[model samples]
Target: MRLPLGLTAAAILFVLTMVGGAILDQLNENMHVRYRDASVALERLEHASERISGLLREAVLDRNVLLTVGYDNLNRTLDTTLNNLEGLAESFGLSREVNLLGLRRLELQDIERRCLKLMDEDRWGEARDLLFGEDFALSRKLYEIDTENLVSVLDDRLRREATRFATARQASLGVRGLALILLLTSGVLFSRRLTRELAEQKRLQRELTAARDELEDRVRERTRELEHANRQLASLSYMDGLTQVANRRRFDVAYPQEWDRAVRHGYPLALLMVDVDQFKAFNDHYGHQAGDQCLQAVARVLRDSARRSGDIVARYGGEEFAVVLPGLDTRAAVAVAEAMRWAVESMRREHCVSDCADVVTISIGVATRQPKPHQEPAELLAEADKALYRAKSAGRNRVMVWSGEDVSFYI
Candidate 1:
């Protein structure tokens, strides 16, 4: 009679174990479905965000109107995804993150509107500026940070849920070991699936990180290229196109800065106003191209003769060049002028139409002054001009120095 009772108890226990194991299996299936759904939704959100970023970046640099359409569709998709995301966030107790995402979405919409308006108006420069502006950069950075944070929070919660699921599986295993032996196989399969999915998730995260890094490197390279181009443009702006020397604008800027330094240091600043002898006649005799060549040759000579790094050689205007010699006295300045004059005479480039020599020549006027605090740089320039007049009046190929109010020929 006892053996029969023991057998009946064992049977009851086995039936109870089977029922409990089935319930646990159902719960695990429900949990797995929710996890899968959340993973799919998060992936959709990531794709949409990445698409929006790429489309907007491309739109800023390119004038393709089609990108606008592409992004607009993505925006609609993003709205739907965000709604789903918000529901999930709320379920996961991430209401604050949801609010932040909503705010960022509105900001992104405003940016898009402004960008689209600029595109419609054909204001690509302004659009580029707006997109690359500090505010826009900051906005994008904040949005990305918020997104990463949301992803991290969701991943953390999911990991906790997975841990709970694992614990429940272990408990089910212990309670129903004899009756639900088949569940061991199911548990092993589920574990393998979870491991594979986690690995895939990690791979996706790594890819996203790599992509972001590549984009940043590209941005940096582009910025460097733009900076180099700007520098080239700025340098070109100050150079004479014909002679490949400093233009009048550069002279104008350097002259005052040098003058201020001279005034402060109590050193003499010298100016040489040089003009090609009979340049107009030379242009008429030799075509304009030859005339330009003549000017370039003279400019090259003047640049070479300056010698000192502090000296400046500039194309002051038509057929005229100016040289600034800082810390040079009148005598030293006259010596430089004479050297330049002698070099051109030695070159002996044939100039049959000249009244001076049979070769091309230049007339130089040298003026040096220890500038006073109250004096203007123009005063020195005028003195140099007067000396230049004296050089031209005296002879075609000579240097004249300004002596107070008078001009003296430099020997």
Candidate 2:
């Protein structure tokens, strides 16, 4: 009797293993298809990134029309790959990764435009320097490597899920085989064994749920970090690295915005261009190290002097600074310039080689205008520059305001 029961249990176990294997095989095939699709897309994006880099290198190094055309062609291909990546974002439901890719792509486009502009200006060395720069190279590496890793991780996760499913199926088969053996030994034993197997199945389900929840938490945390980094990058872009004030780029952005606002409101807009007196002599006497410190001091004074909500102080290239005054008339803007002069005098940073005085001083040029449809802002800038030149020609430590008349309106 026992021999017959054992034979029956073996027969049932064989059937259970065959069914489990067939189900796992079908699921595994589906997993492979998804993995292949994601990997192929990621690889294509990586290839496009490398091609863009190579094209840029050739265009910059050769400085030929044909190379430039080749570079442009590759840029178009890169744009297409970027679109494909966008589509993949929708397919994978990965909004954060897509957003980062979009940002990187836009930055690359800007770099490309800048390269073209430099080439047009006949600045071959500068254009070559740009492609060899760390910023663009790092940005390309980040986006390509990140996307590739993301695809690999996703594929790995899919593989893991399939493996877990197979493991569970195998475990179930083992339990069923045990139940059959127990039944062959005694009917009561089979019922107890089935009850224990159901409890173990619930335990495994709980483990899987916990793991998925943890993974979701990690994904959300990573998204937050990326957003914070983006904000920081934006802030740094507008700031002057040496002086800690707004840079030329920020001034360019703010100038148009303020001009438009002043035109709409019929308010006065003022611009003050300041030059550190005898800065070249100071640099020559004190050495470059001291020159940097002096500039920082001047920037600090200017920054503190223009403390109003609508006031902007920026480093307008070497040894020159500018203050943007919104909603201020000519007199008010002149007063602001005088205060800035006094602020620099108060710093008392010694410049022995100076023609103006024994200390660091600044000559300021003030220009004010109420915006009109007939006039252009460029005129205001030209007038201010002329006034600055006058201040420098006539003793370097004074303030001169520009009037429509042929001369500077001295203050």
Candidate 3:
């Protein structure tokens, strides 16, 4: 299941809080360890500095005592103390200031060397002068001051580090306490809210399911009603108003299918383009209402004349009708057109305004071809139109067949 954005954010925040708490605890522990290590180093440094100062005082009190003590022993002690000071400095993490301490140690060694040289020459005065010289006195005083400053610095650093550790520890404790409280509160609230939300989600899901089922039932009922209405609409769209024959649109749609079936069966397809002779004059003289009745009678004749089940009769346009006959050759098409013309002549409807003596007549153009593998529907339509023009020109009230040789007339 996927959580909402708000819930996901809350989960992420909870994880981050836990991670932060753990990091704070680790930092606090590290600070305590560092402070303890620093304190130990500071104490060692202070003790070592005091020992070095005591050795210097002893050397000052009795210059002859250095002979009894042996120069090697004193030098060894000083060297050991210097090494200890270096170690202490390192332990205290004062690597950057180690050089200053080393320089002071070197100065002490140079003083010892000078004292040894004087003792070899047995010149007490020069040795005393060398030990108590202004330069040496100044160097010793500077060394003492440096040691005191080091002690003061170490004390201050220890105090500061202690204060820092205390602050950090206290802060960590406060943060942990607050995080614990927040975690408990958030967990409790989230759990309660999650339960409530789940219940609400369940209720909503049930309502949605019920609504969807009801909607589906209504949709099914509406679908049956629409299907019945559609069947009625289809009938109206295809049937001609006057003759109850197929209309042009329906004929156009059905023609292609029939033509394809004829091609598959290697049969002939024929088309007849029929027009009422002098229809315009008849409409002008007999009135439009009479002309309409005439057109209806003509359509009925065409419908009765097309005998085959595969044949379709349709009103092509004003005073023109088309007949599509599958499995009909040129002879069959001509015979059907002649029969339709006779049917109209038998009507005996008078057209007093028309120059022709006939009551009503029809001019029909017939074209027939056996469907071939690559024959296009356009080619057949063009042939039929050519035949139609020929029928119109050769005097109306006759059937004319398209001849393939008349290229110019067709073009």
- For candidate 1, which ten residues in a row score worst on lDDT? 177-186
Residue 127, model 1: Cα distance from true site in angstroms = 31
Stretches off by above 4 angstroms in model 3 are: 1-225, 407-411
Q: Rate the local accuracy (lDDT) of all candidates.
A: 0.80, 0.77, 0.69
User: What's the TM-score of every candidate structure?
Assistant: 0.56, 0.64, 0.45
353 Cα displacement, candidate 3 (Å): 2.6
Worst 10 residues of 3 by lDDT: 59-68
- Cα lDDT tens digits, model 2, 199-273, are 775797698689779967976896698578668866766777779999776887798788888999899999999
What does candidate 3's lDDT look like per residue over 18-101, in tens digits? 466467556655554554444444444444444444444334433434423444655565556556556656645665455575
lDDT of candidate 2 vs native?
0.77
Which of the numbered candidates is closest to the native, going by highest lDDT?
1
Q: What RMSD does each model have against the real structure? A: 15.4, 9.7, 47.4
**Root-mean-square deviation of candidate 1:** 15.4
Which of the two, 1 or 3, has more TM-score? Answer: 1
Two-way lDDT contest, 2 vs 3, winner: 2
- Give the per-residue lDDT of model 1 (tens digit) for 226-302: 67966886687678778999977789889999999999989999999999999999999899999999999999999
